[model samples]
Target: MPDATFKIFRGDRDGGELYEYKVPIAPGMVVLDALHYIQAHDAPDLAVRWNCKAGKCGSCSAEVNGRPRLTCKTRLDALPLDQPITVQPMKSFPVLKDLVTDVSWNYRVNKKIPPFTPRPNVEWKMDQREVDRVQEFRKCIECFLCQNVCHVLRDHEKQEQFGGPRFFVRIAGLEMHPLDGLSRTELLKEELGIGLCNITKCCTEVCPEDIHITDNAIIPLKERVVDDFYDPVRWFLRKLSGKKH
Candidate 1:
């Protein structure tokens, strides 16, 4: 309906600055559309990673007005257009160029998690409720918006120590699978650093899938970690049996 001012970051991993562009607004126009307009009319060299503009692909993620969100899903009308809308790369990862960030670290962390291993001679049939429980986790699109909003990765830069909320969700899916046989409690304790999360629910707030990352996935996983590593009776049993968790 009217022209909107956009301040988009333009640069590489070394550094960058916000470049302002004026775009004419349209009904039902999302932030990604505005970015596409900028690419067409103004900065042709602008680098943006996007696949499905319908918001399912999760490739069009960026911080809009200082919030981690999928640009494809963020309607311009929802933002305060009176001020310049700022679109920038996810802060937790290394910026590749413009709105693209190096999220390869997440892949490396993912590689550490063991795959779903069905219990020996287990029946393939599972309760519908159990199936539904793990199904919630399958909705993760790997947008990394949750990872970007997490304080451990964003503020403390604990990429080496902590696996952000995204992987915790992954681990939860594997751990909660009824027929799956695996204990990732040890991985959560030492490698993934689940203790670092204080359950602020910041990651949950930014999730595009509306996955209950803190309540359903993370909290249950944390309890499992405590039961495996911190339960007094279990600890004694492990000690008596000459076993280490």
Candidate 2:
């Protein structure tokens, strides 16, 4: 409708500065479109990580209007485009130059998850009813938007201790397996630091797939961890049985 000014943060692990750019507005342009136009015409050096601009790939995640959102999916018309649009790299990760944050940390954390080691020689055949539970986890596109919005990692900078919400979905898919039974609650509690999440649901708010990241995934795992370690009745039963589950 009118001219739009973008105050974009530009820089990296070493150092950088915020640069402003003006671009003519169109009827139905998204934020990603504007960034691409700027990169093509004005700022050729703009380093942004975006692929599958249809919002399937989660690479182009950044803070739009100070909220962690996928740029490709956010429409400019949805915002107050009459003013300067502030676009910045996700604060949770190291800036890699202009709107692109180093998300390699997510891949590193993903490696720590134990693989689904199914039982020995057990012919695994799951009914749709049983398979339906884990299918919800399939909706996740590995967009680290949830990871960035999580205050434990974003604000408090607890990546060394807390794994963030993305892994909760990861752990949930594995831990909830009907046949593949492994006690990761201990690993989640001690090694991975699941206790750091305070159920703020910030992760849920930014999820593009609308997966119940807190209620369905993280909270259930937390309850399981509590039942395993903290429940007095379960502790007594385990002691009497002389067995650990």
Candidate 3:
């Protein structure tokens, strides 16, 4: 209806500031449209990383009004237009420029996860329910919004010790797959720092895919980590067998 004011971050890893731009709102206009308008008419040098302006690409992830969201799917109508909409890079990652943050750290964490190893001499068949279980994890678009929102990474800066929620979801798919033989509970307990998560469910709240990240992926993984490392009976058995998780 009226013009919407956008306070978009501008600059690089060195430093940056929010430069305001006024955009005339249109019906069905999303935040990305306003950003494109700003790019064309106001600040040509503005660096906002985006692709496929639809929600699926996840390339347009940024903080809108201090909440991590995909700008492409964030409808301007849904936001309060009376005040300036603050668009900034995800705080969990280092800003490379404007709204773009360096997300390569996610890739590095992903590399640490072992690939799916199917059990030997196993039937290729699996129950439909089993397929459905892991399929939920496959929906992850790697927006890294979960990682950005997670307190472990966002607040504590535990990148060296934690793999963040995105990787936990990836590990969930591999670990839960009926045919997968490899066990990543050790990886989860040690490298990914699964114990660090307090299950605030902030990651699930920000997920555009609505994949139940907390209930389905992270919690079950936490249980696996506990069962493997904490259960008294399991601990006793491991000790008796001279085995280490």
The runs of at least 3 residues in candidate 2 whose Cα sits more than 4 Å from the true structure, single-residue gaps closed, are: none
List where candidate 3 sits over 4 angstroms from the true fold: 238-245
- State the lDDT of candidate 3 residue by residue for 1-245, as single tens digits: 58999999998889989999999999999999999999999988888888888788889899999999999999988999999999999999999989989999999998999999999998999999999999999999888999999999999999999998999999999999999998999999889899999999999999999989999999999999888888999899999999775
Best by lDDT: 1
Clashing pairs in 2: none
Per-residue C-alpha lDDT of model 1 across residues 148-228, encoded as one tens digit per residue: 999999999999999999999999999999999888999999999999999999999999999999999999999999888
- Regions more than 4 Å wrong, model 1: 237-245
Q: Lowest-lDDT window of 10 residues in candidate 3? A: 49-58
TM per prediction:
0.97, 0.96, 0.96
> Per-residue lDDT for 2-89 in model 2, tens only?
6789888888888876788898889888889899989999999998889999888887888888988899999988989777888899
Q: What is the lDDT of residue 44 in candidate 3?
A: 89
lDDT (CA) per prediction: 0.95, 0.87, 0.93
Ranking by TM-score: 1, 3, 2
Order candidates by lDDT, high to low: 1, 3, 2
Please identify which of the two predictions, 2 or 3, would achieve the higher TM-score against the true structure: 3
